[model samples]
Target: MRIADHATWDRGFPVKYLLVQEDEDGVEQLWGRCTGVEGFFVDPVPPPREILTLRGCRPDGLLSEVLAEPDVSLRCLGDVCVEVCDDEKPVQWWTLADAVVVAHQPHQADPERYDIVLGAGVRSEESFFELPATSHFELFAGTRVAAASAGRCSGVDGLFKARVDLAPVPMELIGCEPAEPLLAALRRPRRSERDWAYLLVLDRHGAVMASRSVGLAITGTRPSVLGGILVDITLTDGGNDRPSLAARPIWAEWYQGSPTEPNLWAPYDS
Candidate 1:
């Protein structure tokens, strides 16, 4: 899917919709409604009016104070944790690594288990704010990777599954493994012209009920250069306004035990 296709939802600004339901086994299933019509899913639009895309930056390069300026958000999806500033008009964001701090409840059991929470002002070590009463999220201690991989099977045993729908394009999912060097999943044959890639990583979780995707503009794709990839940053006159997801029916059908407004497409699609 072309990056331009994501502008349909709210004009040029895209919104990410999420619906969650529990299965008969009581495990929660998340039905994510994202932008992109032809199988490619871009992260939600950023808050900044203008985005400056940079290509060929070292993936492992230490972000400098100057380059990591205010009002800019970066979109690099994978197992990495991110910090999005909701209060800022331009929403300064960055990939969170050593800066992330997960705290476990004093009496909490199995502190390693966690859930994915997506929204503005999600409390992290680097970002903190007073959340509105209507907000829903979970704060627990564990590595971001551990949270994403919990309650799933297959892949690297304790690893998590990453379902990426960037069709008609070849992309790689690379990350580090326990006691092993950096690893990259082999690019599998596309199931169809609209197929999504499923790779394994040691990562989001039960506590993590939701999180917003990043807005990205990709002019082209090429292999990583010096462990870095390049992108063209587009800037806009974005305001400080934020968008909230309302509960909506994912399907018209209603089951006996379904809520008044059913949000999940089906209980078993995942």
Candidate 2:
């Protein structure tokens, strides 16, 4: 299945949609729908609309002055930490990074393992009022990959699984280890053809993250809708032994004649 469109709700927001189609033997066969978490950020309070005139204020000096000023509110979403400037003077200049702070919380009663860092501001929005500087500020959150399921056929047995190693690595990679007899089972083809394909990656907990109705071609036919197919793609481990899997399903369909397209038929002898 190929994605017809992938769209997000808005800038600095996380909502999104994935549209897919499946075709086999030149005919449309099946479809799939999947949804999951995406990361985004919003700044409710942007720099003041009116520009503040700093006749001789050096850029650095202006920022430093603003740092000491009051009326600025900074909050970290992941750790839920809020910092407010108490100085009465207005801030003249400020670096985006300096204004933001990550709140690292230690495990209660235990100092080794961190409970969680609240510095992440995914899906959070900020607001700005009349201020002392003219600057563009952007909020960004790291990307995360999650899985969701669409439609499936009972004839397509077997599960898809994947896992992500928390450990660091040079590059991301996905590996597939099919059970023995995989080749024979797949080679002994059927007359109807397998239109839908599934890719499953097993996580540490054995849960599977699957992408279904992926598009692929088979037997020299270029169907409009295609299903997922498995290919041997390697990823650099970067020095880490463990890695997560990226799996998706492929579906194919036979072609049906369109209203304007001419139909060709072979003569049948009776």
Candidate 3:
């Protein structure tokens, strides 16, 4: 487990770390403990030098470039992996394995930053899960996962694979615009008004690993086959909520749509 109370700005300077905190009025303020590094910024606000100590740090998707560097240490907190920055001991940490439910809470100051709230052992239907707040998993919620395998496909060279897990209900895929080159290589004729399905691939812990929308064609009568051009994968960085994918994999599972979750309307005939 890695914990951090400060942010690191990796410029070629003696002091590369700074503490970011909110004042009593809830405004973000930068604080420094070191001396003789005033050339980098306008004001070097001072704080209690004695209490300013380093500790273990957590690295998220923003640090993807940094994590790719040679010999960066890493550790896993539950299913999420984080980069190790310093030798200091971590002050706090949490595990997803112990969580019964996970809720996403966006940071007030930074819109991109969100904290993953894990519900304790108790399971309740009337909690934040029932709130009107946008539930990211609303599409597949209350639906069962059906396992289907995909083979290594050709002509999908440039496009990355993004798996869409489904429930029993059929739903439409939203927010996908494939490049012209990919559309031209497909065997079927492309159309502007064609219906597409939005898909999401989640890790075992229910963290969104990747998502995309693809124009799928359903064929046959009873046992129908679904075909679609693989779209470019949109990898997510759920802030400190989940770990990022190391690399894209081939053929993620696509579940069967159910009527219960009407979000994804079933296009196949009975």
| TM-score versus the correct structure, for each prediction | 0.16, 0.16, 0.14
lDDT of 1 by residue, 1-270 (tens): 222222123333232222222345765333222221111222333222211221222222222221243522342222233322233332322332222212111113333332222122121232433333332221112255453311210111111112232222222212111111111111222222312111111101112222322222122323423132311121111111212222212221221234555554555333
Per-residue CA lDDT of model 2 for 1-270, tens digit only, reads 222222222223221222123334564322222222111111232222111111211112223332244632333211111111223532222222222322223345545322221112121123332332433221222222321111111110011112222332222112122222233333453433542333322222223323323212222212112123322221112222212231111100011212233332222221
Q: What are the per-residue Cα lDDT tens digits for candidate 3 across 1-270?
A: 011222122323222222223345766443221111111111212111111101111223423222335533332122221111123432222111222112333445554443333222221222122212221110011112431111111111111122232222222212222333323423354444523333334332333334434233322111111223212222121112111232111112221211245533244322
What is the model-wide C-alpha lDDT for candidate 2? 0.24
Ranking by TM-score: 2, 1, 3
Better of 2 and 3 by TM-score: 2
lDDT of 2 at 177: 22
- Predicted structure 2, TM vs. truth: 0.16
RMSD of 2: 23.9
Candidate 2's C-alpha runs over 4 A off are 1-174, 185-191, 215-270
